[model samples]
Target chain A: MSGDPILSVDRLMMRFGGIVAVNELSFSAERRKITALIGPNGAGKTTVFNCITGFYRPSGGAIRLSHDDGRSIQLERLNDFRISKQAKVARTFQNIRLFPGMTALENLMVAQHNALMRASGLTVLGLLGLPSWREAEKRAIDLARAWLDRVGLLDRADDAAGNLPYGDQRRLEIARAMCTEPALLCLDEPAAGLNARESGGLNELLLSIRNEQGTSILLIEHDMSVVMEISDHVVVMDYGVKIAEGTPQAVRDDPKVIAAYLGADEEEAIAVMESGT
Target chain B: MSATSARPSHAAQPSGSAFIVKKALISALVALVLFSLMIGVRTEAGPQGGLIYWTRFGDLAALVGTVFGGSIIVELLRQWWGPVDKDSIVPKPVQSAISFAGRWLAPALLVFAVLVPVIFYDQRYILDLSILVLTYVMLGWGLNVVVGLAGLLDLGYVAFYAVGAYSYALLATNFGLSFWVCLPLAGILAAFWGVLLGFPVLRLRGDYLAIVTLAFGEIIRLVIINWQSLTGGPNGVSGIPRPTMFGIPLDNSDNGLAARLGIEFSPTHRLVFLFYLILAMALLTNWVTIRLRRLPIGRAWEALREDEVACRALGINTTTTKLTAFATGAMFGGFAGAFFATRQGFISPESFTFQESALVLAIVVLGGMGSQLGVALSALAMIGGFELFRGFDQYRMLVFGIAMVLLMIWRPRGLIGHRAPTVYLERNQSISSDLVKEGHG
Candidate 1:
């Protein structure tokens, strides 16, 4: 938490035709910390995640990603794939997007495509089965194996990813994103379909990633248990605008945060309902 | 309790015989309507050059009766079989047996292929047919890299074939280059066109990509036909030089290969040499593809096929992945085309039509996309099967169509539906085709 901000968002805005999906929003993610973005449905949490990950170009704002080596990237200018490649940012979809036909190990191996592509000399050396390519391939397999082991899917390495259980698929996806060795991991609802126990396991996994790998995490979650327990900082949004932002404890106690989740005071809700009727 | 009392639903079920009769009657009615004109009526030119008409009521009735009987038999089999499950039509034991056969089929076919030339060296017809089959097998393998491995549906694969053929034809006829020298040049030229095709269609997917590629093929063919001065237009280029055994020409002259080796002269020597030549080239294509599947780029291609969005998210440059796939597949097509030009000693726009592309694509699809053995088997079945139906006269196409339809119904994903993972840990498992994405582009 004390390190320089790994990612800083300045006055982000996203407009889809006439509707403003995100309006002049700003936030910063501290290095090696788990930051939670919590909002009710249709609050544009995922949209912000998309903007930061380069899936969408923000209408107005600058996303700056600073590396430990003193290099700063303007993510907004980069293409979708380059965000992950050069900017060192990785993300997982709310709906799992694993390469279902490939094996679990292959899913991880594919995530290491950039590194392996270079080592293979853009496939010319690898096509020749050169020793250099062989060593690179072996090292890639080892890295994939290590990530698979970390996610506890080492035993099911050869199984098609589509055949894995729901909980395992979620963890496998996270492992795949980590295989890219990203400086920041953005997850959209990692616990969306998980049971209580699986969410507990996910909490431990996310904690270990931050603790051991020193990778910053930004996650959107409806699961309060996940948000409250592991998040060092929390930002709450309501109707595409930031409602509250602070430490998890401070955000939880904020009246505005409670109003956004539980709906405004009783009188205010009744008045709003009367007007609608 | 009595069986009927215990399960009242059983009593409501129609008897097997009655159900079969009802279904058969419906089929007979439909067949009667369909064949009333098709089989019952016929028209021909009379002796005076006027039209003559006749009705064959007996044949129409016979066709209807056959449909009725066939429907009854099929219904009976269905009842006896308990239930029809589309996914598991072939029982587990039978599937395993097929897979077990598949395990050894590759090497066995290789052994048989090696011996075909020797066994049929005396028969010119068999040798020519074998060369045709090998040429198609090579084409199927080439297109498999794009449509199968990379999941790019290319309806213009024949354009690359034409490019290869024309490259060799132009180089050999105009510049007096040998086939050996022009072969690689043809492949390179085709690969260049492949990359060119890759650029404009980079953003297109699925059906749009297919339409654009189809148009590309037609454009190439039309260009060849209209460019009369360069391509000889519809007449085609003839006397294209034949391939030689290294530097030795396979001819009857005193300076020929047979004379240099001190062997007796026979036209069969050149045929045998051509057979082995195409065989070696086809094998080269197969070997390179197999090797590529184990490389990073190959894995990236598969990854792109599985989920392009995921590939992009994982930092894979999908544009280059697709371009490489097109280039590689086209290069092989070029090689096959060069061999074809030399083998026939002739080339024409008619030879590189949409039908040729469709035929090669059919071999790849029927063989199972991404399965090397499947493509090879499919090519053998399709090309050889078409030739087998030669005696069917006008009914040849009808019979071939029925066979293709039956094969598709039997194995919807092709002859081999499952994909074997390129690299595996612990134990290798074949993925069901259901999970394999056909790719957006």
Candidate 2:
């Protein structure tokens, strides 16, 4: 991996009234690597994710994404929609925010909206069913089908996204994010409600995405097994502050991380860390 | 064990006979008081030149007796049918047959619409009434793009209708343009207004958006009224040219359509022609909407409707999605407006009022949001039913309100509750509206 960081979040602070949800947080996710932000409940991991994804403007900070093409974007300056469209930053919600009424194929098609819209000549040519627009639609459906196949949901492409089983929906969400062709993918609690097997499936999906597409991923995960197995770098937070940042193994062994997040003293924390996690 | 009371009782559950009878009696008494005032007394000018009331005890007695009888029958039916409704099931084959008809109903209605004016060519009243119904059908379809597809509650849709009407009116009268030339021009002008109105309210949503649109509609109407030098105001612009076949008008001139076609010079020819024109326009609206629904922008519109947040996350620019929906819908409204101008040969601000907006919205809601066939069906039912009940005068609105309430209670999702998913893989499936969530985007 290149030493240059793809995303650099500097002194990020988010406040809701008097309460600081994210306080002067700083972290850098390297190019084409899986980065995990882990913390206890209300440790501001999601708040940080929201800030990065442009769902919420940080009270103070700079979130910069430096492209391989040598162009850099200040994500905080862009609107929520432009963050995804222009910045090439795609994200999934903690609670699975798929378009519930649309079919699974349509959910993926919707992800490719900008590409299809441009091909449609901003809808005029599409209305006339022009050849170029038809070709774009065919290509979009092909891309959607390929993603569906990868996610093992090709058979259920006609089913509504809401009708998909939980595990499949999780996979579909990743596939949807992939359809956007983002340079950086952010996932919030992807394995939050998954069973052991589903969590394993998610780990494989995230790994394959990184291996095949080489897209950098920034994720907030509660499931340590998935995080430990997939994450190249781990950042641990407590009370809106990053307490530990290192490789997964090093961060897992961090005393402050265990004391604050795992609720263990130094001695017991060492024993828990040594349990081959 | 007492926690059962925490959960409210099921209102649909069977009640005690004594309780039911008591409830029915109360309803009967309430009906008695209401009908008493309506039917009990007749007011007339007295010999001394003052109003006097004459009591009609027989009429009051008959009304009270009817109420009691009606209430008892209703109570009995409710008791008997309540459980049956919960338990009833249709035979498999019959259910399939109904589903088959439901699937084909939209095309069937289109066929029926094309055939109606022809079948009633001899009856000018029926043709005229059908024309009116088709006009509302077009308006409802246009509004469906904004309200049904985009989930934008536009209470001032009549503003676009006014813009369309006035565009055709002013153009035809002032510039002496043909109706055909002005039709698309009116649509374009209305779409421009739609964008103009859309820009200021890009950030607003739901009820606030509705209120703003309502204000814009009133502003347009007030402008048309006050700017009499341009629009002719309350007196309206008259002698507007009617849309003709090529250059031949639907008139008794030697070069007119009746003369060219060697048909009788009856006014019914014009009514029939107008009916077909409006029908064709409504179908075009339906076609374009259906085609748009499958396109990228159209899917964006629906995605925005379902979840605006998710739409933004998906990288769909919601501002453009919303504005395009407004412009497209307004264009259709303009087309319908131009047709209206041609059909009436006159235009007035009174024609484009809040009441007109309400009527079109009622058609869309009563039909089923986003369902083309449902809008057409509802327009026919609402507009034709109104014509049927013309003799009732003051009671017409009251009866219409009750019908609407009953319709809502019967089918909350609307006449056609199933939503056809825009894209499908294996087979096209109609989604139950209960499964479709709106305004979450």
Q: List, residue by residue over B31-88, the lDDT tens digit for candidate 1.
A: 9999998889988999999999999999999999999999998887766665433441
Residues A1-277 of candidate 1 have per-residue lDDT tens digits of: 2558999988899999999999988888999999999999999999999999888999998899999998999998997899999999999999999998889999999999999999999888988889999999899999899988998999999988988899999999999999999999999999989999999999999999999999999999999999999998999998888878889999988777777788887887666545534
Give me the candidate number with maximum DockQ.
Answer: 1
Off by over 4 Å in 1: A1-3, A265-277, B1-22, B44-52, B84-99
DockQ of candidate model 2 = 0.53
- What is the alpha-carbon interface RMSD for each candidate? 1.4, 2.3
Assess every candidate by TM-score. Answer: 0.94, 0.90
Candidate 2 clashes between residue pairs 3 or more apart in a chain or in different chains: B306-B441, B307-B441, B308-B441, B309-B441
Off by over 4 Å in 2: A262-277, B1-14, B22-99, B260-264, B391-394
Count residue pairs with overlapping backbones in model 2: 4
